[model samples]
Target chain A: MKKVEAVLIDLSGTLHIENTATPNAVEALKRLRASRVKIKFVTNTTKESKTVLYQRLKKLGFDISQEEIFTSLSAANDLIKKDQLKPMLIVDDAALEDFSDVSKFDGKPDSVVVGLAPEKFNRPVLNEALRLLLSGGKLVAIHQGRYYKTSSGLSLGPGPFVKLLEYAAGVEAVTVGKPNVEFFKAALEDLGVADPTTAFMIGDDVRDDIDGAQRLGLKGCLVQTGKYRSGDETKISPPPDLVLGDFSNAVDQILSHIGQS
Target chain B: MLVRVLSISIGSTLLRGTCNHISSFTVKRLKSQASNMDGVKGLLIDISGVLKDGDVVIDGSVAAIKKLQSANFPFRLVTNETLKPRKTILSTLSMLGYNIDEKILFSPVPATVEILKRENLRPHLLVHPRMIPEFEGVDFNDPNCVVMADAYEHFTFENMNACFRKLMAMENPVFISLGIGKYYMDDDGMALDVGGFAKCLEYATGVSPRVVGKPSRDYFLAAVNDMNLKCDQVVMIGDDVLHDVGGAQAAGLKGALVRTGKFTKRDENHPTVKPDLIVNNLAHAVELLFGTSPS
Candidate 1:
C-alpha cells in the first residue's frame, strides 16, 4: 500500500447503479472527502448532459462538485474543442447541452459524434451519419461500451450503433472516454498528479476501470457492484490489486491501504 | 434441376426415392452455398407492407405469389398482424386473387395459443376485436399473462392500467407481445403497433415481454421448421429492417429487403438490419431467388 495522491472513482456501478445510490456510498464518499483525498468522479454515461448528471448526483446526496464530475460527454467536448472540429452530434436530446458550443447544421460536417440516443437511432438519422462518414467525416464515439444496465435489464447502448456506423462507413471511430488512456490521464492530470502510480482507480467494470487504469501505472480496485458479474476478476489479466464488496468496502480498503503505505 | 425434385417426390415410388436422394444432395449444396448464398430453397414472406398496404393489395403482388407457387419454392407468409384471426385473413387473401393455404400462413395467433398451453398461463388479452376469436379456448378468468397486440380502441388507458395492476400483482407473470413493431402502415398512414406500449410496460415492471411474432427467433424458427428447411435455406422478404430483415438474419435465415412499404434507401445501409439482398419489390426478390424471368 502507498499514499494515494488522487483517486478516480467510477460513478455508474461503483457509486450508484442508475439513480439510486449504492448502499453506504454517500457516507463512504463523505469520509473520503473528509480524509482530504483528491477525488474525481468519472463515468462513461453519455446519456445525459453534465449539468443534469451533476444535479442528479446532488439530489442523490453525494455532495460532489460539478468540477469534480468527469463524464464522457465532457471528454468528447474537450476532444471536439482540441481538434477545432464542427461535428454532427447524435446524442440524447438532454445531452445536447454538452455540445452547445460546437457548430451544428444541416449538409456536411467534419465529424459525427454519437452517444446513447435511443429515439435518434432510427434509419434516416443513422443514414445521415453514414453519408457524412462516407464523404470523409470523422466518426467520434463518446464511449463504445456495448450494453448498459437498466433497472429493467440490460439495454443496448450506443456502442452497437457506433459500431454500425463504423461498419457501414468503413471507418474506425475515435473513442474519447473510459478505457481510453487519454480520458483517464486527463482526470489525473486535472488533479495535478504527474505520476499515476500515486493514484488509485476504483470501479465495478474490470476492463474499463480496473484493467485500463492498471495499464497506466495506477493501482486499480474492483468493486463487486453495478454491472459486476461473477468471474469478472478471472476475465482480466494481472488481476486487480484488490477486490472488495461494494463502494463502502472499497473506501475502507483504500483508507487502510494508504495508511499501510 | 433442384425444383423438379420437389414434384418428383410425389410421383412414382422409384422416382420418389431417387428424388429424395437428389434433393438431399441439392439441399446439402444449398447448405454449403448458404454460407455465401447465391440462391435460397424457401421464402418466409411478409404480408402487410410487402404484399398489401392496409386493406388494398399492392399491384403485382398476386402475380408474384402465383409465380412463386409455379416455381415450386416452399414458401410461407410470416406476418406479425395479430389484429385478425386465420379465417378472416385467409378470406381477405383469397378475395385479393392470391391462392394461399391456412397452413402456410404462420401468424402469431396459433403461436400465442401454443405458448398459453405450454406455459400453462391464462390470457389477459389486450388485442383487436378481430383477434378475440383467436384466443377462444384460452382461460381468461385467472389471468397470469398480459397479452398485448395492436388493439387500437381496445388499448385504452383503463384497460392498460388494469393489465398493469394484474402484471404487478402476479409473481413472475408473463408479458406477451404479438409483435414488437414500432408502427405499421394502415390505409390512413403510420399507426402505432405494440412495441412502444410493450416498452412502456417493460419500463414500468422491469421485465421484458416474450415476443411471439415477426422478429422473435422462435417465431421465425417455427415457420422455417414447418417448411422442413434449415434457417439458411429460407430467405425472408419484407420491408421493415428491424423486424423483417434483421429478425430473419438474426434467426440464421437470410433476409432480402424489398423497397416497397416503409422501406427507404437508408434501410439498405443500416448495419444492424443490412439485408443479404436488396430488391425493388417482392417480384424482384423472387426473380433473384429463382434466377428466372417472371411469366
Candidate 2:
C-alpha cells in the first residue's frame, strides 16, 4: 500500500538455483529497475566470495553489478576489519579471497570466524577452533541458518557448527548475517534509506529473509522458491506480508502496488 | 529416628504462636503423624565433598563411614563424578582409607546406560576416554542419541561437532547429560564441568538433554529406589546446596548441607533453597543421625 522506494532482492533460491536463474527473474528485475526504484541484492550465501557470486549471476543473464550485492561474507568481512581482529577463518577456499586483507591464523587467534565449509568441518580443525574459544577467543558466525536449498536437496548450514563451538567454550558467538537485525540495518544504512518502511525485502526464507525484514519495519515478500517447504507460511506469526509463487510474481505485485505495472 | 522426633517437637512448638494463621491442632496432628510414621531409613552421600576433596580424604569421614557400616545402616554414595568409572572411584576411596563397596556406589554412568537400554536408543558418547569401558556391550554405531559427561580434556571442538551433527540428523534427537553442574573442584582448582558442554550441544541441536545425575528428579528417585526406601525415608548429604540439597528436597527427600569441600557461606544463606539440615561435616551429620559421636 505504501510507496516502495527501495527493494532488497534475495539471490540463490529466489533469483537462481546455483547455475540457473529462476523463470522470468532476469526480465522482472530489469522491469523493476526501469521503474527507477533503488535496488540492492541481499544474500546469506556464505559458500563463495561476492565476486564469484556476481560472476555467477551475470552468467545467468541477470544485469547486476558487484556494488549492488550485499552478502553475509561482506558483512563478516566488515566486522573483522572493524574489530581489527586476527581471525582463524573456518570458511571455504572459494570464500577466502574476500578476507585477503585480514591477518592470517598463526595457531594463536583472537577470533574464530565460521561459515559453510563442508571440507573443514572435521575433528582436527574443529578441535583447534574449540581450543581457541576455551582460551578466550571470540566466535563470529557469518550466518546461523539451519539448512539451505541445493541442487540435490537441503544441506546442513553453519548454524549447528557455530553452536558447537559456542557450547563447548561457554561463549556466545556474534552472528553477522540474516536474520540478525544488525545485518538488515547495515544494508539499509549502505543504501542511505533512513526510513525502513519504504523498502521491501523479497526472498524465499520465511524466517531469515521475511521475518528479519519485518522486524526492522520493512515489508516482507516471501517467494515460494529456494528452501521453501509447504506449510512454511504457518511457521511465523503475523505471516509474511506477501507470499507469491516466485521472485517474478513478487516483482509484479510490488510494481502494481507502486503503479509501475 | 530421634532426629525426626526432635524436628517434630521443634516444628509444633514454632507453629504454636501461629494458631490464628494456621489450625494449630491440625499442624500438631500432622507433625505427630509424620514423626511417628516416617524416619530416615537410607542415606545418599556425596563423595567428592563429603568424603574426600579431590583425592584428599576429609577428616573423620572414614571413621564416620565405618560407624555407619557397623550400625547396619543402608546408604549409597551418589556421585556426579563421570570422569571415572565406578571401579576407579571405589579404588580411589579404598586408597584413601575409606573402605567403600562398589555395589553401594551410584554414579550417572550406570544410570545412563540403563536409560539408553530402556529407551532402545544407541548413544554417541561425549564422555571421558577412561569412562568408555563402563559402556561396554552397548551399540555405538549409527547412534540415535548423545550421552555427554565430563570429558575434561576430551571436550574438543571436533567431538562436540560430531555429536552436534548426529543429533541434527536425527528426526527425534535424544541428548542425555550425566550432570549439569557449572563447575567443580579438581586437582588444579575450579574447572569447567559437563553442564557447559551439555548446554553447548543443547543450544546447537535445539534438544533439551535428559539429565541423569544430581538435581534430576529421576536420578534422585532412582538412587532412593535402589536403596529399597521411600523418598521421605531418605536423606541426602552434600556440600553443594543447589544440586544436592535442593535437588533432593525437590524429590521428596530430606537434604543435609555439610560445611566442607566446596561449601561456602553463600550456600548456607541460599536465596531459594533452605537445606533441611546443616552440619559441620559428614561426621557431624552421622552423629546427628545416630545420636552419638563416631568412635
Candidate 3:
C-alpha cells in the first residue's frame, strides 16, 4: 500500500514472450511512465544480448530504452571486469556482444561463465569446463533457473548444467542473477533507491523474483504468466505481497494504490 | 545376556583393584571390553576387506565363520561391492574357502530391486553391465527412477548426461545411488566410486539420491532386521571406519574396525568416530566374542 517510487519489471513472460507483447502490457507500462515513476527492466534472460532484447521490446510497441533494462548478462560482465578474469564463456552466440570487451584465456581459463547455451551443453564442452574447474578455475553461473517457458513447452534451464559442473569439480558456483541477493542489491543501487521497501519487483517466478525481492525488503508482485505454474505461490513462505493475473493487472493494482489511476 | 553383564562387572572390579599401576592402554582396553561384552547376539560382517581382499581370503577368516556356525551365532555378509552381482560375490567367497550362504548375503542390487518393486518405479540404470541380470524382472520403460552404481569405464559423460536429462524430465526425480563412497581400492590402485558421479546429478537436479549401501541407516537396519535381532544386540565388522563403524554406530549397532584391507593406523584414531572395538582381523574379533582362539 506504500506509494511506489521505483518499479522493477521482468522482461520475458511478463512484458513479451518471444517477440510478442503480453496483452495490455504496453498500455499499462505507458500509464506507469506517465506517473513519473522510475522504472528498470530486470530480467534473467541470458539467451540474447541487451541490444537484441531492447530491439525486440521496441518492435513489440513497448517504449523501453536500452539504458532502462538491467540484465544478468550485464551483471556477469560487471563481475568479469571487476575481477579481471579471463573466462571461457559457455553462452549463446547471440549473447556474446555483451561480453565482447572481456578477454579470453588462451589455455585453461581462470573462470567459466555459463548461461543457456544449448549447443555447448554437449559432453566435450562440459568435459572441457570440468577440466578447467578441476585445474583451479571458478564457475560463474549467469542464472540458475530450473526451466523456462517457450512456445512449444517448458525447456531445461542452465541450473542443471551449472549443478553438473559444480558437482563434478567439487566446487561451488558463484550465481550472478536472480534470486541472488547481490543481483537485487546491484539493481537497487543503480536506481539510486536507498529504501527497498518503496520499490516493487514484478515477475512470474515465485522463488527467484517474488521470494528473492521480498527477502531483501522489496515488495514482490507475482504475475500468473510466463514460467508460473499453478500452486507456485504456496512454494514460498510469507507468500508474495500481491498475486495478479498478469503484468497489466499488477500495474493496475500498483497505480491505483498510489492514487495515479 | 545377564551372564555377559555379570562377567563385565566382575572384570571391571578386577581391573579397578589393580588400577594403581594399570597403564592407560590397559584402561582403554578394559573400557572397550566392557562396552562390547553386552548383548552382542549377532554380527553384520563386511565382505571385501574383512573376509577376503580381492580374490584371496584373509588367513583364519574361513575358520572364523566355521566357528560362528558351530556356535549357532546369527550373522550376515553385508557388502557395498557393486561391481559384481550377489551370486558372483558368493561364488568368489566360496572359491576362497568361506562357505557363505546365498540367503545370508546382502548387497545393494537386491535391496534396490525391492525398492523399485515396492514403489513400482521404472529405472534408468547406470550400473556395471555384469549386474544387469539381478534386475531382470524390473521395468525399464519410461524410466521414473535413476539407479547408479560403479559403472567403471561406462561412466562416460554421454551416459551421465543422458541420466541427467532423464531425471530433469520427471515431475519429481527419484535418484538411487548404491553407495556414497568417495573412492575404493581396485586393480589399478584407487579409483573414483559411484558417489562422485551421483553427486553430479544430485547437484544438477537439486535432488538427493537414496543411498542403499553402507552408511545409510536403512541399509544397516535392513540387514540387522533380517537376523531377527535388535540393533543394540548386533555388531558390524568392517575395514572402513567412516562407512562401516561410524554408520553402524549411528544406526544403533556396535561397530568393530578390523586392521585389514584398506585400513591404516589412522583409522585406529579416527577423529570423528570412536570404534567400539579395534581388532587385528576377523579372527581376533571372533576370539573376543566367543572366547575361543579360532586360529
Candidate 4:
C-alpha cells in the first residue's frame, strides 16, 4: 500500500551543514528528483528566508527551487491561515513581510506566530506580546528546536527566544514546525501522499529529524555525517529505525524501503 | 430517574432519545457552540510543573481542576508517576488534599501490567515487597515485566540487579519505574527517584528500558484517552520540566512549565526537554488556562 510520493530532506545536518554538502547530498537529491520522487526541502532552521536558504543550498551543490522548500516560515504562514486571525501590530521584518500577500491583522494580532526570527527576540518585544497574550492572544510557535549550527559556531534558534516570549506572555503556543503533525501534514499534502510510512526522513541529528519521523510512524534513516557521527548513535535515548553513513547512500536505502512496502 | 433511564437501555438508546428531543432553538445554539469549537479538540496536558510542585501544589491548582471539570473541559493527569500504582497514586494525591478525579488518572502501572501480560512475564516484579500484597492474582514465574517503584525500600542495589537480570534475559523487556529524579518534600526529604536507577541499568544494558512514567509518552497518551480528550485539547500541568514537560512533548502533548517546587533555571534548561509555556507555578498555569491573569 505504500507508494513513493515525496522525499522530505532535512536542511541542516541532513543535506548540508553550512556551505558544504554532507558527502552525497547533491547526488542523492538529484537521483531522487530525477526518478520522479517529489522533493520538498524541509528545515527547522528559519534563520534565513526561503530565497537565502535556496541560494545557500545551491552553493552547497543541491539544485532546489523555492517552490520545493518548506521552512518554518512557510509553516507559520500556513498556521495563520488555518487559525483565521490577523494582527493589529505592524510586524517590521523581512520574515513577516513574506506573508504580505495574505491579509494582515487589523490591530495587534490575536496570536503571534513565532519562528526563528533573529532580530525580534528581546525583553521589550516579549513584554509587549505578553500584554496582548495575557489579554487572551494565542501564541503559535513553529517548533521547539533550540540550537542551529552555523559557519562560526552554535547559536540559539528561535525556540529559546520563543520560550522567553512564552515566559513573558504566560501562554502555551500551538507549534507548526518539525515533528509537529501539522508540519508533516503540510509536507505530505504538498507531496500528494496519504500515509506517513511511505516517506523516510534522513537526517544527521537523532532527536530532531529522525526520532521525530519515527514518532509519525515514518521510517527514519539516521545519517552520521553532520552534528553526530556513527558511534554517537548511543546518545539518542530513543534511537532511530535505521542508521546510514550519509545521504549518498540514503537514496538507495530509501528506494529499497519504499519499494519493499 | 434520569440516571436509571440512561443506564436501563443498551448503548446509544438514551443518547439517541435525549439528543433528538431537544428544541430547535437549543439545537441551534448548541450547533453554533459546536461550530465555534470546530477544530478545538481535547487538550492532552502533561502533569508535573503545571499542577503540583513536588508536594507544594500551585495555589488554586486543585480549584482550577474543579472549574475545568465543571465547565466539562476534558482534562486528565498525564503523569509519569511510574513509582506508584495508578489507583494508589491518584488516591494519595486525593488524600494529600488535591481534588483529582481518579477516573481520569492514567499512570503507567496498569498499562505496564497489560504490556507485561502481553509479553508473557513470570510476574517478576521489582516493586516494594510490601506492595507485592496487591498482586495476589498476578503470576510470579518467568515474569516478563519488571516494575520498580522507587518510593518504597524496594529500590535497593540487590533489587536493581534482579530487575536487570530479568531485563537482560528478555528482548525489549518492559521496565516501568517512577520519575527518575530526586525531590525534598515536607515529610519525604532527600529522595532519589527511579530515573537515576533506570539510567544506571540502561548504561549497563545498552538496551534503553521503556520508561512508562511522567515524561514517558505512553502514560500521556493513556491519560489523554482516559479523559476522552483529543491529543490537542488538553493542557499539561506540571512543575518539573524533565519529567513533565519533556514527557508531554514526547507524547505529542502541550506543556505548561510552572516555576515552583524543584524548578530552577537549571531544571528549566535541563539539556533536551523544552516546555511550551512557562508560568510562576500551578496557580499561574491555571490562570492562563482559564483566560485570566495570575494575581
Best candidate (score: lDDT) = 3
Candidate 2: tens digits of C-alpha lDDT, residues B140-233? 8889998999887776656766777788678889999898866544564446667666765675556998999999988988888788899999
The list of candidate 2 runs beyond 4 A from truth reads A12-37, A46-48, A55-63, A76-143, A146-175, A192-195, A223-231, A244-261, B1-38, B119-125, B128-133, B136-144, B150-172, B182-193
B1-295 per-residue lDDT for model 3 (tens digits): 9999998777545332322233466445644664474689999999988888889788768888999998989999899879888878888988999887788898988778878988899999999899999898999999998999988877764577668778877998999999976554456444566776676677656679899999999789888878889999999999999999999999999999877777886888999999998876777678778764323
lDDT order, best first, reads 3, 2, 1, 4
Q: What CAPRI-style quality would you assign to candidate 3?
A: incorrect
Which pairs clash (backbone N, Cα, C closer than 3 Å) in model 3? none
Q: Lowest-lDDT window of 10 residues in candidate 3 chain B?
A: B14-23
Expressed as tens digits, the lDDT of each residue in A1-261 for candidate 2 is 567889999998999988888989999999999988889999988989899999999999999999999999989999999988899999999999988888564556888999988778654576677777777899999998766777855666788678666765778999999999888888998898888899999998898899999999889999999888788888788799999999999999999888942
- Best by the DockQ measure: 2
lDDT of 3 by residue, A1-261 (tens): 566788999998888878788889999999989978889999889989999999999999999889998999999999999998889999999999999999555555789999888667654576667777877998999998876677855566777678767766778899899999788888988999888888899999888898889999999999998888788899899999999999999999888877852
Hey, what RMSD does candidate 1 come out at? 11.4
DockQ (C-alpha based) per candidate is 0.03, 0.17, 0.13, 0.01
Per-residue lDDT of candidate 1, residues A17-90 (tens digit): 78899999999999888778899988888888788888888999998889998888988998899998889888
**Candidate 1, A173: how far from true, in Å?**
3.9
What residue pairs are clashing in model 2? A167-B200
Off by over 4 Å in 1: A1-3, A17-27, A33-37, A55-64, A82-85, A105-111, A118-138, A146-157, A160-172, A227-239, B1-96, B106-295
Give the least accurate 10-residue stretch of model 2 chain B, judged by summed lDDT.
B14-23
| Backbone collision tally, model 2 | 1
Model 1 clash pairs? Answer: none
Off by over 4 Å in 4: A1-3, A87-92, A229-238, A256-261, B1-295
